[model samples]
Target: MADTYPWQDELWRQLAGREQHAHAYLLHGPAGIGKRAFAERLLALLLCRSPQNLEACGKCKACLLLAAGTHPDAFALEPEEADKAIKVDQVRDLVGFVTQTAQLSGRKLVLVEPVEAMNLNAANALLKSLEEPAGNTVLLLISHQPSRLLPTVKSRCVQLACPVPDEAVGLRWLAQALPGLSDEERGELLALAAGSPLSAARLQEQGVREQRALVVEGVKKLLKQQQGPSQLAEGWNAIPLLLLFNWFCEWAHLVLRYQLSKDEQGLGAADMRKVVQYLADKSEQARLLALQDWLLEQRQKVLAKGNLNRVLLLEALLVKWASLPGQG
Candidate 1:
């Protein structure tokens, strides 16, 4: 069985120890919060041949099978590719799996992660399976954005919310999880992740910190007439489109915050603070607000549809960003 995060220990005990568990569970939470790992641990506890203290006995046949990812009675479903939707055929296969008997004699388990990735057709296909309460089967649906799921699908299952930990707790966990990080780097990553420790660790591992530094510097150079919008956009072509937009949105919010309160606390990532402050001082307050709205709108459009021309959209935003200083 995979070990769960410290914050998940209480919830794990509650769900694992319960004899009358729900047939379907909707575990909803922010991304990178370890909900999938928690669900896996619970699934293992359910399938263990000889459970020990409401947890899995790792030496059991069931545990060994699950560890090997060859468990006959268990199925894991998710998007076949990154940024793709889960198709109706996948749910149809799940429906077929649900109607069958458990081969392990203990119970059958199905794990669906990021369930919101399922399209309308796929979600409708899953309703019947969720409605049928089987005696020896459990369905675990993990969602980062539960609001995107159909209400009918959500209403059928028991909902378990996993919340972001407090700043101190998140930073403490990050400190141990990423031992090489300096205190400043740890704090910046935690803030950027909005107090999700696992997300902060992933950001560091993915070099988002370095990318953000480059982006911030690019913004400064754009305002100072040292770089052109097309040049900056081309240089930023390697950064994920949504991620770049999100950072732009965050920086814009900080500019607005500084305009409103003249406080430094509104700034984000420590490395970007100087650049954000520079923009806040030189840019028009009203223009900053309008640009912030534009960034938010573009971010939404990009997220909803994947077919947009990334380079052109980014170039347009950078052009607008470059004009901010003179707009004042």
Candidate 2:
């Protein structure tokens, strides 16, 4: 993974200087960003008995083992089900890894992807190990929601806030990752992606790609036509609210950019220019900004409630959007 997406020079340098790194490290960022991949690079570094440089020496036997996912010194724990949780039992399992001596006899890196999945009990269980970890054992926790972590756990780790890359950088990188995508498809994929190349790759898969295109297409159609809001509301039954909120936020950004810059060469620029041009002369520009705020708040609300009725929430959002003065 590091081979494809090399660390920025600053990040690599920071990692290199940390001879006595924290026992627990937090890699937090927006969902679908490359936290897991970055964590893997760090894991490879920690486990590498001998490295050629700051990066994992790809030729080393340890690197080969890490790539094969059978590195005895490395352990990764993720949620059992999608968006469910890491239970207490999962943390206890880490206890097992920590108590045992490193199979590699050098260093061990335990990666907990989406550490926010840990329920209260699970977090507490891990806290014990973090407080008194075995020598040479390091805990690397990746999360989309940093605030969800317990304050105690938060204080223990050396935190890395992974900033989302610029949209152009992310899109260009992703366009180069996939081999057979068309220009339109690549641009659309970047538009739908959440600034995460990992997520962007997943969006390239046939089913996911089609769904995202449809979602964006739906938004375009509705926002472009009078009473379009009503049409948008019609499809809310099958859409997830969390996803809808995200889509709306992205759309607003596109519209705002397009309107402000009048650029049509790319996905966001073109779309945003169209929306901005349409509404810039209107008295309701302020209302549109308000709508953007509402969408952002809605996204936060949906994420906060793990059990929200996503479909209903989307429909309600559409209704509100349609009722707005600027909606054509």
Candidate 3:
């Protein structure tokens, strides 16, 4: 059975208690907020021969088959490789599945995660199934970035906005999810994950805190001329490019915010507060804005999985960062 989160209780109630389910549902939210799990739970409940109190009965035949990954009436469509686009041929196969009669003579469920992974052709192919869904079928589409989805695709389904838990709720959940870590450590992890509890737990598992500490120390040394940009860039070869870009992007935002508001509280995480403040004080707003623009452009390339020279990119980023304190 798919495990639901405490923050999803209300949304689950609203969804599971419905008398008539939608033919297709678009569950949209930020990543790592349990939207996929929620969809899985709903799929199980819909396919179960017997459900109790708006939940799936694990003992049922359908539930057993689903648990074993042998359910004939359920289809999951995703990219073959991580971070790759869902091909048009894959969507074509799904269209064929959608038109078939359910083997169990019950409802069929189709789950597509991060629907934005489908490019224009694939998305257009999916529209065929969405337009003419056959028999008792429910399509659950999960999207972390719905703004990238086509307007026509967005219009065909019941759009459901998934909930993002507040900081206090996230921290409480993190306490249970990461008991080995102290409260302060968990708090820092949660902040690093941008307030998503599941993401925070994932970051902890990935040693993100340790990586962050290394990067912070490197940034401080770079500013003080103790470490050169090329050396720091090469030393961070093990860290993910996207993760590095995300942290730098965040720091740039914080610096600009502090420069404008002079709000010390807005300097972001404790590890980089002083660095952000120093940059804010010494860097010109125009230079910072230009750097932000460059970062955003490169970040888009990173997201698109462009063929980038990672070492060169990191070196360029660090060189630009090292120049932030002085006049442009």
Candidate that would win on lDDT: 3
Question: What TM-score does each of the candidates earn?
Answer: 0.92, 0.76, 0.97
Give the backbone clash total of model 1: 0
Please identify model 2 stretches exceeding 4 Å from their true place.
Answer: 1-4, 31-33, 55-68, 163-172, 182-188, 206-213, 216-240, 251-269, 272-294, 326-328
Minimum summed lDDT over a 10-residue window in model 2 is located at 266-275
Q: What does candidate 3 score in Cα RMSD to the true structure?
A: 1.3
Clashes of 3: 0
lDDT of 3 by residue, 80-195 (tens): 99989899999998999999999983789999988999989999998868866999889999999898899989999999999999999999999999999999999999989888
lDDT of 1 at 314: 88
TM-score between model 1 and native: 0.92
Instruction: Say which prediction, candidate 1 or candidate 3, comes out ahead on TM-score.
Output: 3
Give one digit per residue, the lDDT tens place, for model 2 in 174-274. 76787687767666676567557667777676356655556656755665554454456566545555666776677666556555666665335343445
**lDDT comparing candidate 3 with the true structure:** 0.92
Better of 2 and 3 by lDDT: 3
